[model samples]
Target chain A: MRARDVVITGLGTAVAGAGGPETLLRGPVAGGDDPVTRLRGPGLRYKDRATRLALCAARDALADAGLPEALDAPEGTEGGGGPLVDGLRFGVVVSTNWGNVDTVCETSATIHRAGYTATSPMLLPNTASNVTASWVAITHGLRGANVTLCNGPTSGLDAVHWARTLIAAGRLDHALVIGVEPVNEPVRRLVGTGGPGLFDGAVSLVAEAAPAAAARGARPLARVGPYARRADPDAAVAAVRADEPAAPARWYVPEGRPAGGDTGPAGLPAHDLSLRWGRSSGALGVLQCVAGTAELARTGQAAALASAGGEGDDGAAALLLLAATAAGAGA
Target chain B: MNVLVTGMGAVSSVGGDARATFAALAQGRSGLAELRGFDRSRFRARHAYEIDDRPAPGTDVPLRATGWLLRAVAEALADAGLAGDLTGVPVLVGTTLRELRSVELNWCEGAPFDAARLHFGTALRERFGADRTYTVANACSASLYALGLGTDLLETGEADTVVVAGVDTITESTYGLLDRVYREAPESVRPFDRGRRGMLQGDGAAAVVLRRGPGAPAGARAYATVRGVGLNCDAYHPSAPDSGSIGRVMREAHRRAGIKPADVDLVLLHGTGTPLNDEAEARALGEVFAGVPRPPRMTAVKSMIGHTAGASGLHSLITAVQALHSGRVPPTLGLDEPIDEVAGFRLAREPVTERGMSLAQVDSFGFGGLNAVAVVEKVS
Candidate 1:
């Protein structure tokens, strides 16, 4: 594949696990305990649980991106107000695996009580599938085009595909694509009986336009790899089981080896940097969306994105977001 | 008129199936009457298209508004003469209300009722046997949004012959809210009228099959070639669209379709008849079409059918397709006094002759400013 210049510029996150990206890199949030829970905020009343998670992530992401603080009403209100929001070319594309459970429950209740008209007018707008993206725009004063992709659990990566395609097509100068899922009673019950999709949170990444990232003297973080990858089930099981026989004290290899990975010099295409997700697989796939950018923010470039193994058919997802071959690990 | 409309569906108060529902709509019959879906005994004036008397399993769900959607989808596919496995085709559905009716079942009823499971995508996939199902929920404009996305998917080679369906039955929750607002001002919904009170709740679904490349049904032609679609968020309000942005979507659609405002023959307006909505729409239409001599002859079908929420745009598009097919544009259903805002627009009160051969445009704005506008051209 030809060299493609891509850099992460903005970040936002709202995780059920207590830690933000800073702590997230150090260790996994799930100590294999009960489900993690995010805080309930004033944002809940105006929007549903799913939306609350999205906003929380967007708040952190924008701040991490080093963009100006956001004003509730307007930017430049230095009267103890937040910094300026990001640019207009910054488009928004978010993915959600299960956004409707809460709203569905709400609408269902209205139907049961006084018929369908029993629904709240205030709540109707936010329940729509695209409301998450639209609300993001309204909250942050983003007027750019928005796209919300709902693809089962592949929502996060689907959002990446949409944003990356748009960027490659020169649609937006810079784009903020996010993946968010919120925990609610109905959804919790549904997932609890499920074989997968155990957790919920939001992760956003910035795909800076060529000029914008370069103008800021920002180095290219990682290659968006040719094809996005989802982990193989059998391989995942092996990784988890092999952990038992590993050295008791030594930390596992941060670099995940490809199945039948070549036995070569420690110079594999993605043979660098440490990758850590508190929870392995399943819900951890979501972290790929965040980790790719987080690594970029810290190491200026992470060699590869990996989903942890060992968890049940908890489908792990990873993309090789490696840096350009300037350090000599390329074709 | 080459654009072929092979299938159709609807779920409204009068009748859930397409044939029965469309007949009622053509006759200008109101679906709003009594409230049975929910315990609306407390409201001042209880009026809604409460879908009671569930249609038979294959017929229509009697007590459920979504039941109409179920029946409608069947009739629509049947009309198109497509019933066997639809495993290969993609499904693009626009819905403002989905198991939203289920919301009440969980919160108000304690836990989710068994009935809610029927509307889930997994169930729909099994029922319809489609390979893909992209459920779009975009408030009132959902149907149009689904259609818009379908057009893009087709253009991008994502799928061929995508089935676009949009439906929503006025749930007890939604109607109760409407009753409260309508109580503030009691009046019939009169689009483009000076005394517009607010929007009314209507239940229904509309389905359109879009085929790509040269492989349409034999001898069947497209009723309208979906040239371009413009979708945007107002970012101005939760339940309303931004006039300025709406104006841009109109421009962008035309630009993408390689046409100009002067080329439009008809403007299918999403006239919910609510004062705020009508005013905002009028202002947006005026701003967008100010350059044209007279705005495209604006006709609203919702005036006759009520606000169909998610399926409104698809219904409007179907009406446009029929108009293009018959060489006549239908008149507005209910318009008493013209709103001062729609000054430059021609509110068609009676069926009019088709003026241009080029194309027609339809607008559908959902709650939260989720807007969708599509350019439909006469099949060559």
Candidate 2:
């Protein structure tokens, strides 16, 4: 079972609606702003709102992959006795740009209003940037090697590169990669000033070894393509010394399951997953990674997910590129 | 890609070093006590988890606890056994509160943007030779992210040795703001408890040392190799977890680690005990392990120490490491009945001594959906 291209199998998360693709697609990409929310957002009860969004995208990606049952344990497995994916290796990747920061603002405000003696006295845990991921671990039960990356701009591509590295190294056969971003009131205040106009969004995909996916009656996604990243520009260029023009062109996403999908560039191969997801926010890179998984789930063929981003000022760009040419060309 | 966690150090409310701190915690001893750091006659906060009565440099008692951060760093460096020039070392320190010392000194009106970036590094040139220092100002995740960055530095070979520290002590503005929000009785902090009033704005600091190349101190036991870290932003809202992509961060961390969900045995949670945060973290955790058999046993670090925002994550993680090594788990001081919204898991309230997997995961979430998680395992 060649374990290079692990495929996406099951996904689930909470968002604006119930944990499902259909429920999530109901619109309002960026949550609506209400004055009441603004006033009480800091100490609001919907703290982990970002986690809800993450769960929704993950769930939808799994459904898009045609493996609704994957959520249930394998046959004869004791209470999900088997791993998310059986003999096939498995891993996970999740990314977010800004985490929970409002708590600090609220904590500070409360402290200022009250004296040192009357501060709101609960253990406020909104300090670390990985709170959402920890919540996910608590929600599910998966406990593989966990990581949290916060590189701005290149966040999405970074997640893919990390996953690609693990896959190429024969570490895991499959990985559930997810990308998400939560829109907080304070975030809105910073975006127009400089922070990218963030659209609180989330996306996920169950990536698996191409060979294993093909063997499991599951149609394969695109073959893994040439993946590279231009780390913190000065750092990458300084360390690597000018290499070949960084594998020219953006990503190419093949339309595997989504029927009759083709939206390739002005000049490229035919047959693509009419890819809709491309401009992955550095944190939401997990979503962009799923673009490839979504395509594979639909068209069913060997596909390539080319993810590359430039650091520091190059305005970081990435795509869930996919393309299916004569087999054995690059794979 | 192996990140080694060498020379662990911390300055919790209890002890000045790792071993001392761990032993104090293991004995069910608490560092919390009467409000001796500052004047609280008008307020009802009679108790606080404060460090000893050592006076700050040219300062009086009953003052804020920001000075502890500077001293803690020095103590951590001493514990790590590093002496030579630290010009090449990378340093990342986490602190949530805007300098209370600077604030009480009447600098609160200073540029809001630059206000949070304040650090003691610049003032002390000889300590850290100004190579590269960044302050991860995220709320609770600050220190954890710094620890995670330390691991990232080791993994990416960015720096031979990365010094990671988390400091946030009792401050007028910090504690004052928390007090205004709660306005409750007994002024206690409960993480993952139903009747939780809110978080206590306690002051504390913690630090650790990471070495990659030479200059390795003798027998500086490596508690765990920081395998990987995951961070994501919820563009949804600055305060919430951006429900949509909360779980993605965990998925990324696990993916990078080349491990699976079922392999995790310990889940050091950021259960803030507040109604909203508890539910949010609970939901996010449930989503990631949506289809698993036996979920990992969950524990909240904030229960023991009132949430030290900037240092909570690292503090929680260090506590988890101590528990893993001793084959015992700490109880959530106030978690009696689980919140209805939180399901599918059990807390190891009583310390359980046993060895299995040695894999543990710690999570820290900051404002603005800034999420970070680290997977640590006891070295083989």
Candidate 3:
């Protein structure tokens, strides 16, 4: 069977200091209720900050996609009386670099300083790296393929590609692709607070087959385009642009790595999200996609490209996002 | 678009390489011993399945798991007959406590460690000149998830050859958590046993070189054909395995493989030996193979190697593939009285040699109810 075209139907954000996706453009704003508090229902006691932020973003994305029944359902009901979507066919792919590091570091410290007796059994489940993704699945009743990508800088884009792959393989019809990073004491100790600070929350996108979205009457924000991963910035850009009829109207480059010279398309306007939102690590790629969707909605642009590569990164990844109106035009 | 396992490598408590590990399993050699990597006086369970021949720590690779991964990758590449520069081949690593031990050392012992080593991409790039690497942390089911991703890459024509690996080392944090969770740790892992205690931690790394069958070199050795992989989340509990989800995933695997449940010759059970896990798995198996004239015989390598955390899936896969080739099913050591749920099922208590085994299924379920099942067929 031929691969199906994947479209982004909904977007959500639980970013610190930013009220909404539109607020992301104006740069970081301070002071707001804790993102964790944005989550509803039980199962919050033992969850780490990353998982809570992911739940918030996931809830928003599902609601934005017009699938609020997935959230409104009673606890344990996969999807409560939803005619539009089936929770069983929905999956989740989460990308995070230092996910739950705070829990891990603290738990280890507790075991080290006060011995094993001092540790709490409730907090032990949070130490697993995939805990955040699992919580997102459990909370929302996404019973399909659940995967967590902890790959370095490009993980967010990788998560997007993985969702597409699953859809094309008929594993799931829809997926919540989330990119989250929590900046806390453990993160500060690990990377140090020097460069482009740390991103404190999460961003998510609801990706599904174009036909599925159309059947559900959901508006497509953008259609996923070609993706490429290469060892260097130039090759990655060139490969993603190889089959495109025209260069992307705008580009979203990796954090701390500005677009210039060979790193980006020559004349296209480039935006570095980290400059305003801090270094999101694994979340940068998805954040860039969200920004691209916003640009498409704002200016009616034809296409946009989001590229990721950073210091100590093994390779670079580039993903193209075509405007929804141009979805029929083959790349 | 056939995904073939062209090469295999493993380093575990039982042995340092895939061949040796399989031999040890067949010989009923147990790798369990007193846990010596860290101070075990405080914990009630002092025993674990740990590798004895650990390489000396290097400044470049501070994390012990990274060394095991590199060694496993080397063996896999060599086994696949692909030597020298692996420039464009993508590497996918699955792990649970990736470099967390290093973090523990740094935080607790004031050891100098670079946080960049937390992910395996940098180390892989430095060692193999790999252009792209993905580190998946799907808990214990991580490696099978990576395998599924690699299969997608192959089937989608993304990459001709992909290296999928899973590696983990015993860390104080995980050990302490399990030690605390289990009221009394069994001296040995006894999967599917009536008196099974809880699971013990293990340290290991395993890798497989997957290639598009048509593109593989003529006469290249193919261990098994990856027919299909089924992945799902129970979305139920944080630490408990849901039998319904397990049964569903197994059926999904069979569906994707275009085969029936009865086609599977041998089943490599997740069989963590934890009361909840073994019971749930047995129930799932019973439901999945309810109508089959002859149910597939099952074995749990963890009964011998202990639970290797994220690496357990790949360890089980490598063992299953080896069993497919050798026709010798490894024993699930320390299982004397079988669990009631597995009453009629043939649980390999001793090494059994049977010819003409063509298909095998491997099951791996992890914390947070992450489940991954793979169906592999013997390649002629």
**Which DockQ values do the candidates obtain, in the order shown?**
0.24, 0.07, 0.71
TM-score, structure 1 vs. true: 0.76
Alpha carbon deviation, residue B319, candidate 3 (Å): 1.0
Which candidate gets the maximum lDDT versus the true structure? 3
Q: Each predicted model: what fraction of the native A–B Cα contacts (within 8 Å) does it retain?
A: 0.29, 0.12, 0.68
Better of 1 and 2 by TM-score: 1
Which ten residues in a row are the worst by lDDT in model 3 chain A? A258-267
lDDT of each: 0.58, 0.54, 0.84
lDDT of 1 by residue, B207-242 (tens): 777777443586454556777777666666666667
How well is each residue in A184-237 modelled by candidate 3, as lDDT tens digits? 887888877776688888999999887778777888888888887778877888
Per-residue accuracy of model 3 over B1-380 as CA lDDT, tens digit each = 78999999999988889999999998788889987676666667879998755444222224889989998899998999887467889788989888887877776676787876788888888898887788898888899988888898888788899999999987777788887788787788999888889999888999999999754677568878999999888988888889999999999889989999889899999999999999999999999899899888789999889899888999999999988888899999988999899988978788999889999999999988988999999886
**Which candidate model has the greater TM-score, 1 or 3?**
3
Model 2 stretches astray by more than 4 angstroms = A1-331, B41-47, B52-67, B70-81, B107-117, B183-186, B212-220, B242-244, B290-292, B341-344
> Fraction of true contacts reproduced, model 3?
0.68
Model 1, position B298: C-alpha lDDT score: 73
| Tens digit per residue, CA lDDT, model 2, A122-236 | 3243433445554444333333323344444445555555555455545455555666666666444323223223455566666656664555545444443433333232333
